[model samples]
Target: MEQISSFFHSIGTFIHSKHQQGVYNTVCLAILLGLPVLIFLFSFFICCHCCCCSRQRKDSSSSGPAHGKKRKKKEEDLWISAQPKLLLLEKRASLLV
Candidate 1:
């Protein structure tokens, strides 16, 4: 890391020296600054993509049957609970008729 930082420092010094003559120092500075930012962004996106893929795999494999079973059970319970209400309504209608 120290060597890499020293290398960049040398390059910055070189560009700074060249800046006085109005050369391509601005372009060099842009490239130097942009490269690390681009690399960081690329790595961040890759990590996010990998995490999302892993989560999707885990959820699909582990939650499918369990979630389906729970949903089906809930639907059945709702229907079962509604039966008495339907019976009461029918009795009321019969009494009214």
Candidate 2:
């Protein structure tokens, strides 16, 4: 624990010397702290979302068989709608490259 603190203290001194409090300091601080917290939160949100979606699927399937067809149709429609945007992205990427 003491070694860890000293290591971080040394790194912080190095960065602080490079930039004496400005946008660079703010960006460094965000990268050092905010990024990890945000990553953890994002992963947690995704995990909860997947679990809730799975439960809903199980409940819906058990409650109704016909609704599954409607759900599939909706999913297909969404995919069809998204294809044009995907193609546009590919075109833009190819042009940029």
Q: Give the Cα lDDT of each candidate.
A: 0.81, 0.80
Worst lDDT run of 10 residues, candidate 1, spans 67-76
Which 10-residue span in candidate 2 carries the lowest summed lDDT? 67-76
Candidate 2 regions off by >4 Å? 1-23, 66-97
lDDT of 2: 0.80
User: Candidate 2, clashing residue pairs?
Assistant: none
Error of 1 at 24 (Å): 1.1
lDDT of 1: 0.81
| Residues 1-97, model 2: lDDT tens digits | 9999999999888777756768877688768788899999999999999999999988987887654333644454434567788888888745454
lDDT of 1 by residue, 36-83 (tens): 999999999999999999999898988666543346544544345677
